[model samples]
Target: MKATIERATLLKSLGHVQSVVERRNTIPILSNVLIDASADGTIRLMATDLDLQIVENVQAQVEVAGATTVSAHTLFDIARKLPEGSQVRIEAADGKMLVQAGRARFNLQTLPRDDFPVIAEGPLPTSFELPATALVQIIDKTRFAISTEETRYYLNGIFLHVAEDPAPVLKAAATDGHRLARVTVARPDGAEGMPDIIIPRKCIAELRKLLDEVDGSVHIDLSPSKIRFDLGNAVLTSKLIDGTFPDYSRVIPTGNDKLLKIDPRSFEEGVDRVATIATEKTRAVKMAVEKDKITLSVTSPENGTAAEEVPGDYSSAPIEIGFNARYLLDILGQIEGDSVEVHLADAAAPTLIREGEKATALYVLMPMRV
Candidate 1:
């Protein structure tokens, strides 16, 4: 295969697909990206790591119509370091791929295109079109809470399903024993009766990258075992986790009636300052809420105690709760509004957090004994 592609165009396309290739591979062909050139002025680049695959198409000047494979990381690095506006000419000859741009030239070993594994496409039973912005909002607000524990494989991904209560909505939720995040958006067209799916953590990350570059609609196709995303010039497919996510609705609190409204910035700053004295292992911060003020304090056996008082609007009886400082900061960071509303039952119950009056996103954090 031979083609000439602009450095910037090739670099961007490679950046999108190369990330799927693993750095170390037992099968040599798995490290290479399949490049196919067509006479109609386009080049297709594909890479995979058994479970996940990404394919991207970019405009190029094609001199020969054929296919070849080369190391994905090496090719991406070469394209990135080339002169900005220079044209990159690539050709396969004598079991090697030659890359040339301006005064620099390099030859990389090539693998037979036939040896590359291709993920088979099957009939997708459900399909829908969703705005890129909506998908980004759901993933960003919940991905942080996904469990990293390997033993409980079911909680390692985001649970996506539809809610029909007050109104129809698409929801995404994630939890790790310590905290949970849930977000909802208006249901998209053609999403009715869609089966619930658990999208793996890696898939969520790759889809997020693709959405960051485009502002159009993303086509989603799903079946019982697999999921696919069509992002205009790029396509991503992955195997769905083979386990059922727990019923997250039960984990969310419904009877936490005590309310505390405070400026998010002030609460975040106070938590940050007092957390310095917390021990590295526990990193626990104690919060005491009274009529008009919330005091955050951290005490460590080796380190001195630190406390900060922040003004808040709370009329409930005095309550003291202890929580992991890092977990509190993560939930606070996702709040977009100036004020945060925290619902509490008591020191032993899980606290519910939300941004102002928005019901689209909510967080539940478990308390730790101080």
Candidate 2:
């Protein structure tokens, strides 16, 4: 196929789709991207790893109506290094694909289009449309908790399901063995029959990137085994995990009443400073709250102790808790307020966190042994 596309635009699109393509492949065509050109000023790009797939459509000035397959990474690299805003011409030759822009010419290896694996688009049983911001919020809240353990394969993905808590709501949750993160939102009308799908971490990351550019909404496609997202120019499809996620609803605390409101910046900074002396294996920061102050301290057998006292709005009975410094930082990164609310019952109980705005976002962290 002969097609003329702007180098920058084509490069960006290739970079997005090519990310899913694995480098060393048993199947030769798996590293190549399918390019189809039509006389109607449109060119489409598609790539897959068999388990996951992405299809993108670009507006190109087409000269000939045909299709071909070329190396996705090589083409992307060549276009990106070219002079800024140069027009790129791609044409299929006898045995290779030719890439030309101004003074630079690249002959990239190609594979037969027939060898490319194409995942048939399944008829989605349940479909819904939601704002990109909402999807981003759920992912941002729960993705950090996703387990990295390959053995407990079910916990390696974010669980998206409808649960009856705080109402019949849409929720996402993930956890390794140490900590758990769960977030719930009121389900929309179209989500009535939304099947519970476990979305892999890689899918969440790619979807997050695409959602960044979306202004308003996104279409969600789901089957029991797969999930698909349709944006304006791009489409993402991922294979869902077949196993079941752990029952995490019972893990979140409901009776923790004592609350400590401390400056998020101060609390975060104190933990950071103290954790510097903490051992790498533990990374524990201890918190002791008094009348109007919260003290963060850390001690290591080899290294001396480090401590910092920060002024807070703590009135509840004094509470001392131990937590991983890294987990505290992750929670603080998502909170957007001057003061952070820490809900506690005792040292052994899970600590609930909020940044004054309860409806906005809430975080719960398990206490670590000091």
Which residue runs of candidate 2 sit more than 4 Å off their true CA positions?
none
Clashing residue pairs for model 2: none
> Lowest summed-lDDT stretch of 10 residues in model 2?
355-364
> Per-residue lDDT for 262-328 in model 1, tens only?
9999999899999988999999999999998999999999998999999999998999999999999
| lDDT scores of the candidates, listed in order | 0.92, 0.85
Q: What is the TM-score of each candidate against the true structure?
A: 0.98, 0.95
Backbone clashes, candidate 1: 0
